[model samples]
Target: MTIEVNNESGLEIDERAVLDIARYALARMRIHPLSELSVIAVDIPAMEQLHLQWMDLPGPTDVMSFPMDELRPPSRDDEEPPPGLLGDIVLCPQVARTQGAEAPTAHSMDTELQLLTVHGVLHLLGYDHEEPDERTEMFGLQKAIVDGWRTEQGLEGPSPAPTMT
Candidate 1:
């Protein structure tokens, strides 16, 4: 899969490393090659605006997903994509940094951003975390994917504990 990451955040980051995380996440989900996913890192203003417009909330969010296949499924033949555009995952590092104060520096931001990308891909696959049960299932899958990636990378941190609510 072609994972395209856009550094719209005005901060320097290792694109290759981020892409590696995305690749790892996608592989775990059994997403095949030629399926492209877009990730955009943004600043707080943009994130806040999008959160307000899309979710009717006033505060900024860590991520927002715009699924290209929001309602339609790819055709049978086309689904074997050598080139299928999944959708867009917009993320905010500033918001992530704000979230970081709640935990460790790098761990919180990176894990949350990675979590959002996986969540975005799941959203593309028609996964919704709105209701209670749905949130449990979706968050469980997200934590699993993130934890697995960390284990493979030999990253140090507590595996996010599963939350029932």
Candidate 2:
């Protein structure tokens, strides 16, 4: 997969980790190996503008996904998905740090970013948490993917999963 990461967040982020987690999630979810994805880490003001423009919300959100070709994760028995533009995942490190500090487990900004990376990838793959059932499924899958990636990376298990409101 062609995964490009650009950090304009003004915060010193571990861009490699973000890219790794995104790639891991895409591979785990069985996306086409030739697919393309872009991840941008933006500053608070940029994120806020995007939030208002795209979602009509007032504040900077932790992460926002703008899917391009609308790729979907293939089932285990299904053939691999065709290569396409999987789209952009915009991450706000400032917001992630604040949220991480506020979490019950008090996760590091890196961990939070990694989790959000996976969450954004899921959104690109057509997983959503708009309804109760969808929330459960999406969050559960998100947790599993992050935790699994952490375990493979020789890192500690994941912190609590983020709730989508």
Candidate 3:
């Protein structure tokens, strides 16, 4: 997979970790090896503009996914999914930092960003949490992927569990 990260958030973040986690999530989802994805980190103002324009929300959120080809994970009996543009995941590091600070768990902004990265990946692959059942499935899968990545990286911190609220 081709995962490109552009950090324009004017904040220092582990862009490599974001890239790694996004790639890891795609791999876990069994996306095509030739699939392409873009992870862009923007400032609060830019994120707010996007939020208002795309989602019609009032403020900047942690992450927003804009899928292109609308790809889904291939079933076990199906062939590998075709290569396509998986889409863009816009991240706001400033917002993420604030969220991390507010979370019950004590963890770094990087960990929060990593979790958002995986969540964005899932959204690009047609995962959502608008409904209760959707929330359960999407958040559960997201937690599992993030925990697995953290374990593989030998990272030590809280599990970054979903808020579940």
| Per-model TM-score on C-alpha atoms | 0.80, 0.96, 0.95
lDDT of each: 0.70, 0.89, 0.89
TM match of model 3 to true structure: 0.95
Stretches of candidate 2 exceeding 4 Å from the true structure? none
- Give candidate 2's TM-score: 0.96
- lDDT at position 27, candidate 2: 89
Summing lDDT over every window of 10 consecutive residues in candidate 3, give the lowest-scoring window.
156-165
- Put the candidates in TM-score order, highest first: 2, 3, 1
Q: Which lDDT tens digits does candidate 2 get at residues 5-69? A: 99998999999999998999998888889999999999999999999999999988999999999
Clashing pairs in 2: none
Stretches off by above 4 angstroms in model 3 are 163-165
Better of 1 and 3 by TM-score: 3
Best model number under lDDT: 2
Error of 2 at 112 (Å): 0.6
**How well does candidate 2 match the true structure, expressed as C-alpha RMSD?**
1.1
Ranking by lDDT: 2, 3, 1
Clashes of each: 1, 0, 0
Task: Give the alpha carbon lDDT tens digit for every residue of 62-138 in model 3.
Answer: 99999999999998846768999999999999888887777888567777899899999999999999998999899
